[model samples]
Target: MRGNLATSLRRRRRRCPIAQYDRLPPELRRWLAQAALPWSPVSALRLWHKLLDETAGNIEAARQRLDLIEARMLMRDAPRIWGVPPTVPPRQPSPAG
Candidate 1:
C-alpha cells in the first residue's frame, strides 16, 4: 500500500506541471507542447520565441501589479473586474458599438 502511494505521488508531481501547462491559454499550450517535441531546429527556435513573447506579456501584467503596490494603492484603489478596461479601455475594445 505504501509503495503504491509513493508511486502515485511521483506520477502526480510529473503530471501536475504538464497539467498546469495544459491550463495555459490555448496558443501558449500548443507552442509549449510542440517545442518539447521538436521536428526541426528552426521550428524549435520559433516556438521558443513564441513562448518568450507569451511570457513577456505575463511579465508586463506582473509589472503593472507591482507598480500599483509601489504606489501604495489599496484594494479600493484598484478597479474591480480584472481584465476589464477603465475609461480608456486599457488596450481593450469599448463595450459600446
Candidate 2:
C-alpha cells in the first residue's frame, strides 16, 4: 500500500512539474496558510504532503517564502504587554545591639 501511494505521488509529480511550497509564490503561500487552518494532526500531514509535492522542484525559493511568511505572522501575533516597573519594599534598618 505504501509503495502504491509512493508510486501514485510520483505519477502526480510527473503530471505537474511545479516545485514544492518552498518554490511557491508569496500569494500561493499565503493561500496555503489559510487553507492549513483548524490545525490538527491530519490537517498538518495533508498540508505537509501538499507542500512537499508542490515544492519538490523549487525547494529553496519556497522555503524562503515560507520563512518570510512565518516571520511576518509571528511579528503580527506577538504579545503587546505594557511596561511596568517592579515595586520592591524598602530595606529595614538593623536594630541596635
Candidate 3:
C-alpha cells in the first residue's frame, strides 16, 4: 500500500495550509483526519454543505452519508488501482424517509 502511493497519479494542485484547516468546522477536521480518501478542503466542504442540507444539519447523519459516498468511490476505484474486481455492486444511498 505504501509503495502504491508512490506510483499513484498525482494531481497538480495547491495544498490547504494547516492554519486554514484549523478554521474548518471541528467535525469536518476530525472526519478529514480519519477519512480513507485524501479529500481537499474545497471538495469536502462542498459535499459537507450538501449533506447538511440533505440531513437538516444532522452531523451524525452527514458523517454516515459521507461514509457511504466514500465507500462507493472506493469500490469504483478498486479495480483500477488495486486490480481487485468488485464482488458486488456498491450500495446506493437510500432516499431520506
Query: Which one is best on TM-score?
Result: 3
Question: What are the root-mean-square deviations of the candidates from the true structure over C-alphas?
Answer: 16.3, 14.9, 12.3
Per-residue CA lDDT of model 2 for 8-84, tens digit only, reads 34453232223444455565555556642333333343544566577784656655655565566555555443344
Evaluated against the true structure, the overall lDDT of model 2 is 0.52
Cα lDDT tens digits, model 1, 17-83, are 4455555555444444544232333433354455457558564453343344334533444456254
On residues 4-43, what C-alpha lDDT tens digit does candidate 3 reach at each position?
6687789677766766678779999899999999987878
- Worst lDDT run of 10 residues, candidate 2, spans 12-21
N/CA/C clash count, model 2 = 10
Best of the two (2, 3) by TM-score: 3
- C-alpha RMSD (angstroms) for model 3: 12.3
- Model 1 worst lDDT run, 10 consecutive residues: 36-45
TM-scores, all candidates, are 0.22, 0.29, 0.68
TM-score of 2: 0.29
Candidate 3 error regions (>4 Å): 1-16, 86-97
Candidate with better lDDT, 2 vs 3: 3
